[model samples]
Target: MHKVSVIIPVYNVEKYICECLESVMAQTLSTGIECILVDDRGNDASMEAARKCIAGYSGPIKFQLVVRAENGGLSAARNTGINNAKGEYVYFLDSDDIITPDCLNLLVERASEYPDAEIVCGDFQTFPQKDVHKLISLQGKNFPESSFDKSWIRSVFLSSFPVIAWNKLIRTDFIRRNNLYFREGILHEDDHWHAQAYRHVSGLAFVNKVTYLYRMRPGSITMSDGVEERRLENMTLIFSEMFAKEVEWDKPWSDWILKSVGSLRYIGNKANIKEKAEHCVSQLLPTVYKNQSAPFILRLLFKYYFHNGVIFSSRLFYKLYAIYWKYKG
Candidate 1:
């Protein structure tokens, strides 16, 4: 079986897709790699470019293009890739991003050393399109000091690692057993997926050096106009359903969940969330731990919203909460 399956979702990234695919083809590991390109039926020649890339490639790696009947968005394409990956480990690579030639080589090496690690994350940096090639070709395939001292490894606090899906090599069985599928129809899907996926990790590690190069596109989703409105809307939905999906609450990592739940200090006014959605958030609060270990303000808000709103306590908490927000936010 292949050691790693690199999943790249193709859309209207014709201009950058070639560099992305070429980097995967140039992996220093050479063998035991399969690149799965999911064609999401974009109105462009990205697939045409992919076909040419596969045809011209004279390497040991196997390339497969899965064509979807319709464009189901990034999450859907990612789900399809996860469903079809036939490797021990799977790595998500955005079509607009490029990885160093030794990226997979080094990640596979680290995974081999730490067989129990479910998710091995490699460092990544954002680069302008003009500098992508230079970034990919930068020297230093190995990091002796970073690897030796292990200063690069960090404990995931509430899944705090970047939240981006790319540049992480995840064990296939780990993802499958935990049902870590990306939710479709959500804008910041990573926010929800990252939180869920990290909480289940028995062992997690990181390769500190930058292995992935993210292209800084002008009209990227995060920088697009009217994005803040969409972000707030999706964040509302994320906080609403994140805990209702029945995560195991009695495990050793339960503290993580407690911290996550205790941090919901939103009183329906922060993001101008609709009254109905705010009610949904309030409903979920009671089911959280009786003594939540989440962030301080979220705990305060929990009392303010869940309790009967005693006038004196409410006023006092509001004053403190207001002060906290004024300085912290």
Candidate 2:
């Protein structure tokens, strides 16, 4: 079996696809690696460029060009790639970005060292430009030293570790056994997938090496116009799903307190969405915070701020969470 399957979803990334593929082809640990390129039926020359790049390739790593029947979005494309992937571990590499020659090598090595790790996260650097992007994304970043449980989820909100698929190497069996597939028909699918996948991860390991190079492409979803409302809606959906699952946790407030405030911060004033969030929080608070043995000020924040028609900022949540983390019994 292949040690790693690099899944690259091809969809109108013709200009940068070749560079992305070359980075994989140049892998220092190319043996037992396969690259699966899922063509999501975009009306572009991306596949042609990928074909031309692979035509002359005499590398040990195998390549598969899997074509979809119709044009599906990024989430669907990644699902197809995961379905077709045959490696023990799978790494999603966006066609527009590139990875270091040792990307696979480092990830596989870390996974081997900690065989119980269902997810292994690697650090990254934004390429060519976007130094400011690096600062905002990397500041306060705290990586776990070894495989850990749900407590590690704290990093998602409190730290700079992001929720992007490209930087995470996921174990194939862990994903399938838990039925963790990307939610289809949505932008920012990674945000949804991040929460879903983490819900089942036994533990996550971190390899702090900079293996991936992230490129800030023009016309990306974040830069597109007329999508603010849609973005808010999708984030609300994702956060709500998380909140639902979190309420079932034995100690929901541990993560839920910070996460709930984080949710309100993003899904601000989206028509009647506040009611949905409030309802969820209302059901959770009496059962959770009243019985949850947490810090006094933290519990006070959630209990009052959630129901008193009051809203707060993520910075306040962070400030309080930082204190809670520093003095948790």
Estimate the TM-score of every prediction.
0.74, 0.77
Model 2, span 153-248: residue lDDT tens: 544532345667886778999878888889987777877776666556667777877888988866666657666556665765665556556443
Global lDDT of model 2: 0.72
Question: Which candidate ranks first by lDDT, i.e. highest?
Answer: 2
In candidate 1, the residue pairs with backbone N, CA or C atoms under 3 Å apart (3 or more residues apart, or in different chains) clash, namely 265-298
Indicate the residue-level lDDT of 309 in model 2: 58
Report the poorest 10 consecutive residues by lDDT, candidate 2: 282-291
Clashes of each: 1, 0
Give model 1 RMSD, 1 decimal.
Answer: 7.7
Cα lDDT over the full model 1: 0.70
Tell me the whole-model lDDT of each prediction, alpha carbons only: 0.70, 0.72
Residue 266 CA displacement from its true place in model 2, Å: 4.4
In terms of TM-score, the best-performing candidate is 2
* Predictions: Cα RMSD each: 7.7, 7.0
lDDT of 1 by residue, 1-329 (tens): 99999999999988888899999988899889999999999998999988887889889999999998899999999999999899999999999889999899888888888788787778777786434222222234342322322223224324244567788898999989999999998888887887677556666666767799888887677667656556655765775576555655433234444444333333233344434334443455444423233464475465554654432234544554555554455
